[model samples]
Target: MVANLDASSKAGSVLIVGAGIGGMGSAQLLAQMGYKVYLLDSAPGIGGSMHLLDRTFPTDSCGICIMSPDQPSYCPTLECGMHPNIEILSYAEVESLEGEAGDFRALVKHRPRYVDIIGCNNCGLCVEVCPVERPDDHEGRLHEVKAIYRPPTRAVPDTYVIDMDYCTRCGKCVEVCPTEAIDLGMAARRSEIEVGAVILSPGYRAFDARIKGEFGYGYYDNVLTSIEFERMVSLTGSTQAHLVRPSDGAAPRRVAFIQCVGSRD
Candidate 1:
């Protein structure tokens, strides 16, 4: 929920360098205490690592993994990105940070999605018309999603983005957008904003098992990372929400995961 747009930032605003769980949760807490927050992430949607994982820990519960459902709690999950005080800047990378502790300016490079965030309503028509397909990174590349797509149906911001790098500029999506939100010519925009404080949580990447070679990560299709395995078992994962082996696309009777493979963690 958003506070008044004109609620007034008496305490000044804070620029959060990442919209992951850490940055978003801090934004929500600070916002509740009366401070404007600019939440930024380099991805097309919020949730960061939370977005890729199919389920939460312990029992694979998805309760708070997706978007927060307007609840009342102090949960420090990435769901706080939906708060009104947090102005999410997805697909934005922070270029530089200037100034001292309390007064800082962040220079952000915003890559264009070619779709107007304000006008688009997350309709799947553009996806239906687009002929290009790519490995779904959100599903840990275990499956495919449209080149023009949203990371997840329940993803925050609820908007679609075009992977311009992989997109063929087919213009088919441009023609099919119902809200006229698709713009094939959108350019990268640079923005600078001032804030009282900065919180950096650029997020983390899973260890590349391919480099280790012992795990046969890239060599063996059957072997997968936790994130990839998560996608295989996730209710929202790419395998029609069911578990399946990647190599043969078969259901394995027994699954085994070695703890801290190639690491001390």
Candidate 2:
């Protein structure tokens, strides 16, 4: 038996707490059902951990090329950005939540990207002028990038973001930018939003292999994490798909894969 519930009585908005594949998928579905979705993420851009991968398991397919129903050429990440019902709130986190299921209030804290998403045209000029260089986290620190850079190749809101930690406030990028989008003094913002429901999809974090000193993750030059190995062989990675030893440019004669390093514990 179906209960004839009044559709007008319930709120029509949803707050999705993560912007990973799972959260993105959920947001797209909800938005299709005539609900407004607020896709919030702590990173400067969306795609989550999956964004760092070269290929997926079993099928060995590109991890970022998620199929979209509306646009065959666009991935879900890009689709979410273009969708009218979905509002991407990147570089933000949920501070608090209150109220009942149908009528909920959330306090969201947003971190400054230090670059205007809509203003910047992603011309790579800022990256060329900026003097500061930092280890690229996306490549497992195997490569270096300018302080101001895109999170990934195909990141949504596809704009440059400043790594405030490494930024020297040199003002070189500011002078060279054609659109005047670089801002070193930008400040964080906070907001309170009302939503009909809350969905928590905070993804998993990679285990720190350094804790297990026996593996020599940090000490040995040849030692590599699963992510590092994946990046090393990735076609778009630092080596351009060439599998070579980190200590030297030579191809490895033999390799060992240790399964269940953190999981077994």
Candidate 3:
């Protein structure tokens, strides 16, 4: 419903600082209550921490599937990112905020997606031809990911993002995309949005396990992070969710975890 906004309008409006489930839920509620909501996140897609787990606790139900529209019991505002009255800006972050409560102004820095979100159809052709492969940061970088790849299958804003750091400028994905969505070069843009209130749901970042050299998080091939282990056992993850050692891709019979790697009294 909020196709455009005026900073001067002090009407009901909100700026949600993250696009995770919490942020999405808050935005949906505020919007349903007659407020213009804008959701933002640094990641290209939503789902946040839930997207990394193999199986949810207590119930083994698939995390992504359970969050779909059919699973209204889970989240009534499923696909909230694309909901009307709510606009989501992914691969973006709030650089600065000015003005007081109920009438705030913000500067959002949007990193280039390389692929146009409006044009992508999720055909997954770009992933097939893109030769650039690197450790997927989504799974805590446990699995391999193409330079141009989509988030989880059910992720909102079902679009692909390019890891420009490892992209070789080969333009293979660009050539293969059916919708011509891939752009090897895209410029970053900034948005100046105004809202009556702000809601922040920026999630926590995984602690770098490499700091504790004694634990061999990166030194030992067999050692893996908790997130990595979760990905290894994830049905949609690398090795087809097989419980295998990263060292030689062999089945692991038993595993041990060391807690509080960086946290100590």
Q: Which tens-of-lDDT digit does each residue in 173-249 have in candidate 2?
A: 99999998878889999999988788899988889999999999989988989888888888878898898988878
Q: In candidate 2, how many Å is residue 139 off?
A: 1.2
Candidate 3: segments with Cα more than 4 A from true spot:
1-10, 63-77
Error of 2 at 215 (Å): 1.2
- What candidate 1 gets wrong by more than 4 Å, as runs, is 1-11, 57-60, 63-82
Sort by lDDT, best first: what order?
2, 3, 1
Which numbered prediction scores highest in lDDT against the true structure?
A: 2
How high is the lDDT of residue 126 in model 2?
A: 87
The 0-to-1 C-alpha lDDT of every candidate, in the order given, reads 0.74, 0.83, 0.75
What are the TM-scores, per candidate, against the unseen true structure? 0.86, 0.91, 0.86
Please provide, for model 3 over 179-209, each residue's C-alpha lDDT reduced to its tens digit, 9 standing for 90 to 100.
8888777999998987877888887777888
108-185 in candidate 1: lDDT tens per residue? 999998889899987789989888888887766577888898856455666888887689987998887788999988
Arrange candidates by TM-score, descending. Answer: 2, 1, 3
lDDT of 1 at 79: 44
Whose TM-score is higher: candidate 1's or candidate 2's? 2
Question: Which window of 10 residues has the lowest lDDT sum in candidate 2?
Answer: 1-10
How high is the lDDT of residue 182 in model 3?
Answer: 80
Off by over 4 Å in 2: 1-10, 66-73
